[model samples]
Target: MSLYMLPLAIGPWQIALIVVIVLLLFGGKKIPELMRGLGSGIKEFKDASKEEDKDEKAKKE
Candidate 1:
């Protein structure tokens, strides 16, 4: 099966369904903690990328 055959664009109904499924699976109490972890992970990834860019610039000098 080719990946191009998939309908990759997500509509509002798909988003709502995904949110509903996540709520059902994780419950209300865990969502905040999950979001916090996700946020921190993204922050660390951004910091790492910035540091890598600085290192590359330093090497080019």
Candidate 2:
């Protein structure tokens, strides 16, 4: 298998267009709620990982 990679082609204009569409669809208030949910989801994932590490350490002891 070749170690060289193919480029996945997404550019700045496409990303900006997507962002504009999302903003138009969701509006400002909904965007904040969506962002808050995203933040909490990330936080929950981090907390879960920390808990799993503690469990592994306990089991090793």
Candidate 3:
């Protein structure tokens, strides 16, 4: 059995089109608020992971 993988390429125009679709769906006013929430969620996840790593190190020592 042979498996073939195709390359996926995304160019500037494709990104611009995606941005346009998102803007249409979310509207300009809500994008900033949504982005802010997403940013905070990501930050919280990182902080939790760091705490877990510190606890693991303390246990090993």
Candidate 4:
């Protein structure tokens, strides 16, 4: 199989455009709520992984 390369260059304008689009789609009021939910989800995932690691260590010992 052959590998395809992606464009590695992204400038400030591209980032600004993406931010603007997100704001437009989510609107000003909803972005904070979405971010809060996203943060909690990520935290929950990390906590679960840590718990799993502790369980594995306990089993091995």
Reference-based TM-score of each model: 0.88, 0.79, 0.83, 0.81
The order by descending TM-score is 1, 3, 4, 2
Q: Name the lDDT of candidate 4.
A: 0.91
Give lDDT per model, in order.
0.96, 0.90, 0.92, 0.91
Better of 3 and 4 by TM-score: 3
Q: Identify the candidate with maximal TM-score.
A: 1
Scored by lDDT, the top model is 1
RMSD to the hidden true structure, all candidates: 2.5, 3.3, 3.5, 3.1
Per-residue C-alpha lDDT of model 4 across residues 24-54, encoded as one tens digit per residue: 9999999999999999999999999999999
Model 4 weakest 10-residue run by lDDT: 1-10
lDDT tens per residue, model 1, 1-61: 4588567877899999999999999999999999999999999999999999999999999
Looking at model 2, how many pairs of residues clash?
0
Candidate 4 local Cα displacement, residue 2, angstroms: 12
Cα error, candidate 1, residue 30 (Å) = 0.2
Global fold similarity of model 3 (TM-score): 0.83
Candidate 3, residue 18: lDDT: 92
Query: Model 2: how far is 54 from its true place, Å?
Result: 0.7
